[model samples]
Target: MAAVNRVFAAQLAGLPVFGPDGESIGKVRDLVAGLRLDQQAPRVLGLVVELATRRRVFVPMLRVTSIEPNAVTLATGSVNMRQFHRRPNEVLVLGQLADARAELGGVRVTVADAAMEPTRTRDWVLAKLAVRERSSRLGLGRRRSSLQVVPWTEVSGLSLGDLTEQPQGAGQLLMLFDTMRAVDIAATLRDLPVKRRHEVADAMDDERLADVIEEMPEDDQKDLLGYLAEERAADILEAMNPDDAADLLAELTPADQSRLLELMEPEESEPVRRLLAYSSDTAGGLMTPEPVVLSPDATVAEALARIRNPELPAALATMVFVCRPPQATPTGRYVGCVHFQRLLREPPADLVASAVDTDLPALRPGATLTEVTRYFAAYNLACGPVVDAGDHLIGAVTVDDVLDHLLPEGWRETGLHDVRSADPMKSEEWERA
Candidate 1:
């Protein structure tokens, strides 16, 4: 194997770990480094190897025989199977240090990566940082951030300063798992310590955070929201689905709920406020105020284009509701709905109104959970519309939401491990050192 004498922390992630005899172990999920009191580089502690069981364990640096481009070879095949827990002085290199802010030559920069090298005594230690300069504050027409590598001691803010004041790093972490599902991200967040979790969450954009929060359990969602600044929390809520946002808000104290709602824009908070007015078990509370609603004049091509949005949930994209006018939720005259398959069969130039399916009954705002469940089952529907007494299309209830309510509490957390541990090569993968 080609040896890796000097490697960036981010580069080590996902590389498979192997024993001295070339038996496969686990993969490198992260590197643990023990911070020092002075300017010296932090001592490299170990590799956080995640096994096929989805359990992570620490493999000490001393046990690593060689670091190759494709794998980390260990000194022995025997390993400590105990779960890895971060010590007080140790920090996850890629997880907590990447994307950190610092000063390089009197200019502010963000850490893109960190490099580690072994000393004469044969101990690995962080030695250099790859940093990208922040954009010009003078509105200089979108200059790209420039990257540079410097000795770790030259940059300020490299040390984990006051945890409360320090900006958390998550760029590399997000990049490594960019393709992960929101549910998978939520599961990963659950594994982090509270402080670390908040740091990671704080680094995510409002829309991304909203998606991940929607998949988390109610208690986890509440706790994470509480940890964020009230303004940021409100912004994230605005980005979430109206029903999920309302559900999360309903769990908070009335005063907290009122304050957050007040922070949100009037237009954004209106649907959420309306949903909160209903009992949590009712259709009004379960349905998302934002459904695929198009005007009767909308052509099949337009309807097809709307549902094709990558961000739209599969359940919500299954059908589009046709209304008279004012296509937004609480739309005019609940005319009828058209299934996606029907739109596919019709000509693109044809009016969507001609293909509407008005025979399926719409549920009322006060429909009980059981009634909603039966409605979906009876019609074999993935999505059903919720209409008001005046026959105004108000919202949509999807099968996924129904499943969330019907499943036992803590179901997300219960199935998280199993979802992550479903590898067919469980026996073939073994850890070393």
Candidate 2:
């Protein structure tokens, strides 16, 4: 068999695979490895090859005859061409593990890369991980950075479900997730098995769980809520955006929905209740009740500060509503809105009233989805305020929520949102976890 000392999983992926007769067969798409409790390292199962037909098939390690930088040669020209299917115990090396966070030698580090070593018997095993540690030194009044690689065995918190049982490992896992975006964390959780997904969710706090739940698909959101205790689920719902919370509640039976609503804080439950009053396809159902609102007399600086809230979605932060006294929805009276650009152009000390765009119109709560779509399209608005019969601003509909309603059904299950990179080393931002 042709030999190579070692190669990182990232480098091995995308290399062409060949038959014993030197005929091209396919290219490496990913590597499958079986997790073992008794062994410190995971055993390499095989390579996932994408054929010319765009179909993926499995090539066992035993069938591999030579390992080279450019191509992997199989022992025989004849091979099974069945499509590959993942076993319960197997995980994709490049797909799942390459950029995951791991604890190496008691220090948390990013798994920037991974390597595999060939065994004496001509098989290959996962050998080491290139863990990155970011450190800065003051040299000549300038900062200097360095990166270090660590052995895979030294990594203790790589496994997902293991954290559920190990207190220290759970803490490390939580810390790792603390640095990651909620959307990214949700994507990772969705890839894991149900049991592991529950374990990870159990370890997260209610606020963090709420953030991640908002990013999950409707089915996943319901599954996770169903798994949690009623009280815990209520608390998480309270923490989520009113629009998202209402959407999730709409999926449950009336009895369950009412029970959960009763368990939530009155203030938190009120907005959701009002939203639930509207049909799911209506503008009221798709809008968020907590848009930034200020009296026309409020200063530009105050409006800017409100929009600066990191938790606010980008579209909602683009404009601030100007309302009359009472200042809460149904706002005393809808006046106008000041776009963020107008706020920036005016002096901070200037009154928001001076910047109000009075020409922009608001949508009635009962406006149909098609009407909302036409409103957004005709005005090129990122978001539009929703009002009642008295012209009171109740909430605002964001473009994202509109698109979510308009997209094809079962879009989430089609893998349209799984954007994780298969090769970390080839990523533009490899240094990021």
Candidate 3:
């Protein structure tokens, strides 16, 4: 008799599958599991296999005669070649569970991968998970150095419901949504039920939620903010970049906008309020109020240190604005900006003013979208400072914000921004029209 076999979901994926007569089949694309309310662990239904023809088919677990490290053997050489369709009660393990977050013994952990085992009844069940833990010593440089295999009963906060239907439980989904970008998480949340979406949002900290909210579509942004408590919503808005916060608030009713603004801290709400005063299509409306600003007298080394801040957005960090006194808004007459490249090429002791690009034209707050786009294209600029009539720098427009406005409506739903190629938890949802 064949030895009892068990393997992790991650290991099982991509393993070559064969027939009882030794004919080659295809590879395992995903594993389907049936959620059980009474049992913490779900039963493994079967496999979604991809054939040589690039067609996906469902092969029941009963047909799986032997499970080995290198391959899975079936009971017979034949398999039903019908297109795989997820049943109403089934969830895709690799598509949805891998990388999901779980809470074990009051400690939050990530499900880096999962495992399955056979019972006495000859049925395979999702039995354990490989949870990752990072040492705190690394701080921002933290890496998954250890993985613990725990029974499914020790985990919580994952939605095990049918992927095509309403999700069941919620605490965290997919390793704090690890190996996935914020925009991708927002896109996935857009497809979830309102309650499920809210659950996922609630599980995240203010900063992470703010990042996800900023990437969501306008309608989804409003819906999610509306679902949150007033104080909670205000906090999230405060956490987001002023430009993104203002854009989201602009979509709400005047009264709703006023309420959230009132609840926000004065310093955080001030810039957003100013941004809201501008027309949506104007340079002022699209610019982020926060950018790295330094005195022209500062050394290149100081400027480089400021840009190294982990919280600074990539686009905004590409250049440092040189300003005079009144360091806040109306940043004393906009002297000029020094590109990061210049800082790298110059001596650390050199004053930033020496490297300032005064020739680059500053954008007027009232400049139209077309004019701004032309300005960027003409100057080959990735970001441009916004100034008032008196040449006081108020904010900056990054290339990303400009592209967000210029892209077609419902661009997030399109696969143009899909990060699946880098995401290990693969799903075919983006392939749909």
Candidate 4:
């Protein structure tokens, strides 16, 4: 009944899901399969679609109208909104099966991909597996591993006993994460089992892991860091935003804080240590040491260029600080700041000092939470500069950080509901089937 009779599970990933009227719904994050106890091919259960609100839900295969190369059309827009939880007999194909060890024709191989096709009953089943030969035991005379596709029934070790509790690599999981935002990736990790979460984190590089860590809730952040070895944990801390790293470290015991700080490079640890010196509820504690700063003599074009960095957060790119001598924080005299809007109106070659906005007063490091909020409201500013007693720029606080502190504890976890509930289909719908 579908437009296509066969579809590769990997190709379905990241595809935009649409409703019958061509309305956009969500994107496919992974495929759910029901493993058979008799070693038969696993049945295709449904799709894990991440909605616009970042909530992931299940869409049964019977509701999927077509499996095209670029899109998956749903039979109807009215679907269950319950959060997806893997049942005892189910497994996430892309998340847990890819890179899993298996045997084909008595030869050991690794699952690289899988394919599903519709049977006469309109039920989809995992019919084929794309596998690669395992590398040689030793490095002496290793050759490139060859890849091939074989029937799922012929592949051993795909049953529930083989994959449900066994450790698997994250090769395919990382591929899906490559296209997601850091925040989305963090949310996805929160939904996975603790062991699986660590597997994915262990496979990630320091910089990428740091980005994901910064987006996670404080508790999850601390938990993941603790799971790593001391050296690797220190590297992750070094890669994180200094203020964020400090916040996470503050949660640990004082002994741990000192040990991690010692392991970090001196230059990298300096700002974090300085942040730790301040009270967590103060402006100095909430501000980030890495802000866009420029010397007074720099041109408007240069100021704009600095903020143009794709990696810079939207709030941090709102303006550029103009100081006297040292361009970095704790610089010379804190002259003033140039708003991003002002840079566009000024001549390219004109010095940034000419366009500086000096009317707004700077925030002191000791400014309380109430004082910071009042300052933001009074000035209608999205970001404010932090200065020491001598008027030296120390850091910049963005509105996002302020909101993070303002929100109640465990706010992130509160929004997520992970319960196993009954099917939404009515008795009438079931009777028709």
By lDDT, the best candidate is: 4
What Cα-based lDDT does every candidate model obtain?
0.83, 0.78, 0.78, 0.85
Q: What's the true lDDT of residue 430 in model 3?
A: 23
| lDDT of model 2 at position 78 | 38
Find the candidate with the highest TM-score and give its number.
Answer: 4
Which should have the higher TM-score, number 1 or number 3? 1
- For model 2, residues 8-37, the per-residue Cα lDDT tens digits are 877776689888889888778678787766
- List the candidate 3 regions with Cα displacement exceeding 4 Å: 1-179, 417-433
Give the winner by TM-score: 2 or 3: 2
Candidate 1 residue pairs that clash: 25-430
Q: Per-residue lDDT for 199-298 in model 3, tens only?
A: 7787788998999998887889998899999999999999998999999999999999999999999999999999999998999999988888999899
- The per-residue C-alpha lDDT of model 2 at residue 162 equals 52
The backbone clash count of each candidate, in order, is 1, 0, 5, 0
Better of 2 and 3 by lDDT: 3
**Inter-residue clash pairs, candidate 3:** 99-174, 99-175, 100-174, 100-175, 101-175
Candidate 2 vs 4: which has more lDDT: 4
lDDT of 4 at 220: 96
lDDT tens digits by residue: candidate 4, 1-433:
4557568878988899998999898899888888877767888888988876567887888888888889998885356676667777787888778878898888888898899988888888999899998755758677767779888989898776777566778877788789888887887787676777899999999999999999888889989999999999999999999999999999999999999999999999999999999998999999998889999899998998998999898999997998887867898899999889889999999999999999879999999998999998898888999989988999999998898898878656443444323556543133112
TM-score of each: 0.72, 0.68, 0.67, 0.90
What order do you get sorting by lDDT, best first?
4, 1, 3, 2
Better of 2 and 4 by TM-score: 4
